[model samples]
Target: MSNRGRDTRTARSRWSLFGPIVAVGTALAVIPLWLDHSGVLMGVAVLGLAFACYAIGFNVIFGSTGQLFLCVGALAGIGGYGGAILADTVGLPVVVSILLATLVSCVTGGLLSLIAVYRSLGVIFTGIITLIFTLTFDALLLGLGSLTGGENGFLIKAGADTFLRKRIPPYYVMLALVVAFLLLHGLLRRSHVGWAWRALRDDELAAELAGIDVARYRVYGALVGAAMLGLAGATYAFTEGRVSPTTFGFAQVDVVVLVMLAFGGIGTLLGPVLGAATFTIVDEILIEFGQLRLVIYGALVLLLFLFLRRGVIPTARDFVAKRRLSQASAAPD
Candidate 1:
C-alpha cells in the first residue's frame, strides 16, 4: 500500500479505538442529569468511578506486564492519608498535598516493581510480598495512631469548605478523572510501549530477547498506574471528607478492584469502567443483604473463576468471532 493508504488506515484504526471512548465519556457525562434528584445513587456512581480508576491502574501493572502488585488498597491509602495529613494537619494547600501524595505512591509502586524484578519473583510471589506490605501498612497506621487518628480516622477539614463537600461537583470531578484515565490507557495501547507490554505479558523471556527492557517497562507501568491510583485516592479523601484504615483496606478496595478487573476482562481498555459500573449497581442492590454482601461477592468471584475466567470482553469477542466464522463457513461457495 502507498504511504497515504497506510496513513488512512492508521487514522481509521485510531478512530476505531477512540470513538468508543468519546461515546462512553459522553454517556457518563449525562449520568448526573439522570441521578441528580437522588444523592445516594449519585454518590454510588462516584464511588464506581473511583473503583474504575483503581481497576485501570491495576490493569496497567498486572494485565499489561503481569506484575500482580496486590497492594492496591495500601498504595491508595498512602495517597489518602498523606493528602489528609498534609492538608488537614500540616496546613498545606490541598492541591499540593494531593500532588505530593501521588508522587509518594508513585515512588513506592516503582520500588515494589524494582524489588520484584531484582528478586526474580513470579506473579504469585510478587502478590505475596505486596500483600505483606499491605498488612504492614495497616499496622503502621495503627502504630502511629497520633498521626493517622488510629481506628477513628480523621476528617479532611481542608476540604470541608470546598466544592468537593457537595455531591454533584465531586461526581463531575471523578467523571473527568475516569475519562482522562480511559484516554491515557487508549494512547498507551496505541504506542510502541504498548507493543512491549503485550509482548512482555505474553512471554517475558521472548520480550527480553527482542530487546525490550522488562524491568524498566514494568517499573514505568507501575509508576504511571500508581500515580493514577494515588491521585484518585487523594482526591477521594478530600471529596469524601475523611480517611480511615478501612477506607483503603484490602477487603474494602483491593478485592473490589480485583474483581472488577477480572469481570470486565483484564488487559482490555474500558474493562475497568464496565466492571466497576456493573458491580457498583449490584452492590447497591445488595445493600439489603448486609454482611451477606461479602458472601455474595465471594460466590460471584468463584463463579467467574470457574465459568467466565476470560472475563466479559474476551468471552464476548470470542463468541462473536466464532459466530462469524461459522456463518462464513455456511455461506455458498
Candidate 2:
C-alpha cells in the first residue's frame, strides 16, 4: 500500500476502535440530566466514576506493565489524607491541597518504584513488596489517630466550600477525570514510553537487552499511575468530605480493583471504566442480598475468568471485528 493509503487506513482503524467508547461516554455524561434527582443514585454514580478513575490508574502499572503493584489503595490514601490534612488542618485552599496531595502520592509511588527496582524484584515479588507497603501504610494511618482521626476518619469541611459539596458537580468532575485518564492512557499507549513498559512487562531481561531502561520505565509507570490514583483520592475526599482507613483498605482497593480490571479486560483502555460501572451498579443492586452477595459476586467473577477471560470489552471488540472481516470477505467485488 502507498504511504498515504496506509496512513488513512491507520487513522480509520483508530477511529473505529474509539468510536464506541466515545459514544458510550457521551451517553453516560447525559445520564444525570435524565435520571431522577435522587441523591443516593447520584452518589452511586459519582462513586462508580471515582472507582473508574482509580481502576484506570491501577491498570497502568498492573495491567499495562504487569508489575503487580498492589499498593493502589495506599497511594490513593496518601492523596486522600494528604489533601484532607492540607485543606482541613492547615487551612489551605482546596485546589492547592489537592495539587500537593497528588504530588505527595506521585513521589511516594516513585520512591516505592526506586526501592523495588533497586532490588530487581520479579512480578510476584513486587506484588508482595507493594502489599506489605499497603498494610504498613494502613497501620500508620490508624496509628496516627490524632492526625487522621483514627477509625472515625478525617473530615474535610472545606468540601462544602468547593464545587464538590454537591452531588452533581462532583459526579461531573469525576466523569471529566475519568475521560482525562482514558485519554492519557490512550496517548501513552501510542508512545515510546508505553511501548517500553509493555516490553518490560513481557520480558524485563529482554527489554533491558534491547537498550530500554527497564527501571526508568517502571518508575514512569508508577509515577503516572500513582498521580492518577492520588487525584482520584483527592476527589474522593472532597466528594465524601472525609478520609478513612476502611475507605481505601484492602478489600476496597485490592479485591475490588482486581475484580474490575479482570472483569473489564486488563490492559485495554476502556476495560476499567466498563468494569467499574458494571460492578458498581451490580453491587449497589446486590446490597440487599445480605451475606450471599459475596458468594454470588465471587461465582460470577470465577465464571468470567473461566469463559470470557479477555474481559467483556475486549472480547466484544474482537467478536465484532471478526464478524466485520467475515462479512467483508463474503462480499462480492
Candidate 3:
C-alpha cells in the first residue's frame, strides 16, 4: 500500500475505534438522569467506576509492567482499614483519612515491590509471595481484633451533612474519583515513566541496559497502582459506612482484579472501564438466579476467554487495525 493510503486507513481505524467509546460515555452520562431510582443507579454506576479504577491500577503493574501481584484484595483492605482507622480512631476527616489511606497503600506497595525486587523472584514466586502476604495479613487482622474489629468489621461514620448521607453523594464522589484516577492514567501512559514501564514489560535486561532503571520503574508502577487501589478501598469503605477484613479475602480480590482484567483486555486503557461495567451489570442481574447464577457466570466468563482471548477491547482493536491494514493494502495505487 502507498504511504498516503496507509496513513488514511490508520486514521480512519483510530476514529472508528474511538467513536464507540464516545458514544458509550454519552450514554453513561445521560442514563442516570432518566432512571427512576436515580440514587441507586448512580450508586451502582459509582461502584462500577470504583472497580474500573482498581482494575486500571492492576493493569499498570500486571498488564503494562508485566508483574504478577495477587494481594489486590489485601492492599485494598489495607487502604480501607487505614482510612477507617484514621477516621474513627484519630478523628481525621473522611477526606483526609481517604488521602492518608492512599499514601499508606503507596508505602505498602513500595515495601512489597522492594521485597519482590530484592529477592529476584520470578513471576510465580512473586505471586506466591503476594498470596502469602495476603493470607498473613488476613490472619493478623483477625488476631488484632480490637483494631480491625476482626471478622465483624469496623463501622464508618457518615459525613455530618444530611445530603452526604444519601446514596447519590457516594456515587458522585466515586465518579469524581474514577475520573481523576483515569485522567492520571492517561497522563502517565504518555509520560516517559509510562514508556519505561512498557519497555520493562518488553524486556527487563534490555530496559536495564537502556538506563531505564527497571527496578525503580517497577516499584513506581506498583506504588502508583496501589494508590489507585487504596483510593478505591477508602471510597468503598466510606460509601458503605463500614469495612471488614473479610471484605478483602482472596475470592473477592481474585474476582475483582482477575475477572475484571480478563473481561476488559489488560493491555489497553479502556478495557478496565468496559470490563467493570459489564461484569458489574452481569453480577447484579444474575443474583436473581440464586445458586445457578455463579455457575452461569463462570460458564460465560470461560466462554468469553475461549473466544475473546485478549479480552474485549484488545480483541476489537486488533480486529479493527487488521481490517484497516488490509483495506490499505487493497487500496488503488
What does candidate 1 score in Cα RMSD to the true structure? 1.6
The number of residue pairs in model 2 that clash at the backbone is 0
Q: How well does candidate 2 match the true structure, expressed as C-alpha RMSD?
A: 2.1
lDDT of 2 by residue, 1-333 (tens): 555687788898789656756776797799899654798888888888989999999999888877788988999999999999999899998899999999999999888888888998877899999999999999999899999999899878986866787768888898889888888888898789889988987888899999999889888988999999999989888888888898889887778988999999999889899899999989999999999999999999889889988898889989999999999899955
Q: Lowest summed-lDDT stretch of 10 residues in model 1?
A: 1-10
Q: Could you give candidate 1's per-residue lDDT for residues 152-247 as a string of tens digits?
A: 997778978889979799998988888898889889877988998999998999999999998988988999889889999998889898889999
Model 1, C-alpha of 321: deviation from truth (Å): 1.4
Best by lDDT: 1
- Worst lDDT 10-window in candidate 2: 16-25
lDDT of 3 by residue, 106-212 (tens): 88887898889888788899899988989998999899999989899998774545454565666666666666666676667768988998888888999999999
TM-score of 3: 0.88
State model 3's lDDT.
Answer: 0.79
> In angstroms, how far off is 38's CA in candidate 3?
6.0
